[model samples]
Target chain A: MKESFSQSMDWLHTWAGLLFGWLLFAIFFTGTLSVFDQEITRWMQPELHRVTPAPLDLDAASRTLNQLAPHADRWVITLPYDRKPVGAIGWQHDGLSTLKAIDSRTGTVIPRRETRGGDFFFRFHYQLLLDQPGIWIVGVSAMAMLAVLVTGIVIHHRIFKDFFTFRPSASFHRSWLDAHNVTGVLVFPFHVMITFTGLVIFWAIYMPAGIQTRYEGDMNAFWAEAELFFEREPANQPAPLVSLADLEREARNHWKDGQTRSIVVEHPGDRHALVHMYRRSDDRLSLDSGRVTFDGAGGALRAVWLNENPAYLTQSVLTGLHFVRFGGSPMRWLYFGMGLAASAMIATGLVLWVVKRQGRHAGADAVGYRLVEGLNVAAVAGLLVATATFFWANRLLLPDLEARDLWELRIFFAAWSLCLGHALLHEFLRDGASLKIWTTQLVLAALLFGLLPILNAFTTESHLFVTLPQGQWHLAAVDLTTLMGGLVLGWTAWRLHHPVRTSARSCHTQPVSSSSGSIGSS
Target chain B: MSLAAFLLSYGGLFALCLAMPKHYRAMCGANALPPRPVLLMTRIAGWLILGLSFVASVDAVGWAFGPVQWVGYLAMSGLVLVFGLPYSPRLVLLLGILAFLAVPLTIILI
Candidate 1:
């Protein structure tokens, strides 16, 4: 009975992993890149090259905001942090909002070329290129991943014994299995935490039954009561606004960490206008809950909201764990590396599904096998090539072209579709085309990533040489990471092309035929 | 500094894995497992090194932020060990030793 249960779990694990593996890989890949989102944003916008020391001039910032958005009903200023060195001002007029980067030193708008930058990848990770339904799809896939993890653990009874056992010199299928097992085991805690926290992050959307039952499906009322904050109704009586600099100073003085993250002025031209200053939360692992509000006309302190209930705090910490927003560069890099490992885990699992089947079928002309193999290449290598193409499009596209951001996104999809088409065509034309396609796509991705530094040097004023000496580590790191990614991909391609051939009699030899029989019989 | 600690932890884990019979024989070109005392010692030392690395991480980024950072370090270290073990055991061992030595040096220097 126990053996049968384990076999059932093995079946559950295999199907769950294979079904959502591609979507999970895409999510993991983009989510990993999102760790360096701000840095990517910076690299994309080279016009914001000069570093401006902080203690940002709010007086100048307010002046620029007033000039740029005089008729807007509300204005928001996002103060610069280490990653984002330029303050950003956002305004809403007639229900339309616009955001622009500002040089804190000169208080002038930085003419950054229009690019969605890192936000594209961050949003893409959660939304998956679709609109509302993409989120739910991602949520479902995440739940499937949770199942795979649990069942995978159940099936692999020798989890600890094989924790450090990675045999690359073993048979091809054995090596892939070992790689998948080791990656999955080593970061088991992280995988479970990340997936669980990821689900929790979208709890309001995914599990709305509680709110629906309690609040009669009135999300606004639930949020208002849960948040315990009141928004004042706007008075149409016209009045001149008080100096934003004074209100900012007042807000800073109230918080222990005197650093304000953003300032929001609502109904700026009315007597009931209110200004809110949000405190920075990077000093702690929890999300920012510090907010101070003032009457806009007199700059009088009105409300101070700093504390939250335990439930809210738990949610925030979970969000922080998934986001890694509170930590500095080293922490972010660590998250990025873990994310890549998780991606590799998913990729290997997908490949293992195909490889394990290949050995079972041997010489059979199975359409299902061909389809899965083609998809394995398209989902893994194809997605990578698509991402590199996105970066390339960012560099090569004309900066001032109309609807430039949309064009860049279009280019990304177009390239991705072409890759999928190529995979399908190759699979139909020739048997066992996946290996060839994988090698070719990997080499292509390597070239694109490897040449990105050169492209940046030619296209922009600030390249690695300039940014490195100027202490612009964010920009320099992007280039250095790209170069390293290229080298690694190139090496992987080379290794795949020329696999080592030791004698079949290794110390830990397990006959490939017997292994395939066991798998096939199961 | 945290990176150095991370490397040290990975090195320690790799050494401990090398002491395992299956991996040891596969990589070391040996027929017999290391002595029981050696395996026990490596296991204990491995846990100690990992614990020390955690302390180093906490030192770098306080108690509040340390665990998350440690999670990342553990993941990366595991990946490095997985990729490095089969192809270049010697280099992996050499780097592991250097990392083990650097832990104390990092503590003193930084």
Candidate 2:
């Protein structure tokens, strides 16, 4: 209970990361997958999923919006990407919310896309579902992550010397220690910066003391500028507004090849109805800040809003850096590799905790080591199985079921909890706690994954090989990734206890030597 | 790649090449680290990376200066690698500095 600063940090790091590590890992793991979320969303819903994306019919969408909500000030539409075919449009009305999707051709509002089922897992990563406090918790966790990154770099004395030193079979703790230190050091900068920026990105919302102190305690004044929602204007004149059709053209001309995503109308029906449009460009990886504003009643054009060199607002710059919308896929790849490294670092940290505690409590039964080991099983191994089960649940669940969204999310947590239960029970039954749990999860995961495509064949009648040209590659990618993960888990499980089988002679001698036989830093 | 781009990319790569060897001697080759020739090459690489960053900053403006944006990542990466030397607390500090500037630097073009 009484430890040094480093020791307290050790406590903080262990419990903080351990308690939420699964959540964080699930968050992070899902988040990384969310980098391709829209794609995955498409994959999950085979009914509307696409392999070859349909062309964006801006005119049709435009016409439909004008016809459907002519009285409303602004209309927002999300263009079809490589994932989904249906276009989503939402217009604001007084106290009411008007959200509908239109078919590309008929301009009809179809049923809102399948409920936010699978998306719950993705959203839960950051949102935590606990409301405002949840944000603070995640924000604090992110800052702690930054601290962990820094302290990790500080503690690992010979980091650069072993830039790529991941020697397996070294010793349970030794090998895991090496992996933790190496990966942590290699990506320390990224880990720290990303975590810091991620926290800062939502700084005002999370820690608003500064804004409250400076801006007369008015959060609106702060949000007004942050989101660029200009102060609402008074409506003295009764002037008929000009069509948003013109502003759309102007945005198209400026950001040629990019389509408009939204037109936010502030103070509709006023003398000055302000139309703000969000448009994307073709030159780069991410959507640009090429937004145009208009005085709707006067039909006058306001200045276009492009993101200045990120230096304008500290928050803007930090948001851009952490979210990685800057240079495109390569930087994303760079960040992603670092993220995976962080994941490895965390995994190794868990193993190190187990292996180190294993010795101090070497009596055939040590509660602390066993507890840590159980956590390792559930958090590390069980979380992975849950992730795969999510995909399996997607394939098995009916798209139109009334409670489909709730059902999908329930399966994810249910599977996760089941894996947790297995972790608790498996270690008690088998001599090699890690190996047995891993093998069991591996086999289960593999069986679930390998059978997914066949289940899809049986359930939906949608086959990946045939769906390729139909913009359904998203489904194929998920199925393929699941199968691959299954194989990896199965392989790791097999390797865990293989030595004991081949040479049972030294079973007594191998006394938990090192590396706990979990998957490598690879 | 532009001069800035080339320097950043190559500088970081070179530093990584040296860094890995120096850190994990048993598992890897004796990268020209700490040795005369390798140290000299690393110093030169460091200088070049810095020089390119300087060039990039000069050529750059509000944010999207072509050279600065192009070369910035390499310079940052190389900087991370070099400063992340063995037993040096400076590596941690340098990363802190980078974290401070990460917003300004990474979002060059915003």
In order, the interface RMSDs are 2.0, 10.5
lDDT of each: 0.81, 0.58
Chain A TM-scores, candidates in order = 0.93, 0.80
lDDT tens readout by residue for model 1, A55-160: 5777787788888887688999998877888888889999888889877877788777789899899999998878679999999999999999999888877768
Q: How close is candidate 2 to the true structure, as a TM-score?
A: 0.73
Best by TM-score: 1
Q: For candidate 2, lDDT tens digit of each residue in A188-218?
A: 6566666777676677687778777899878
Q: Worst 10-residue stretch by lDDT in candidate 2 chain A?
A: A501-510
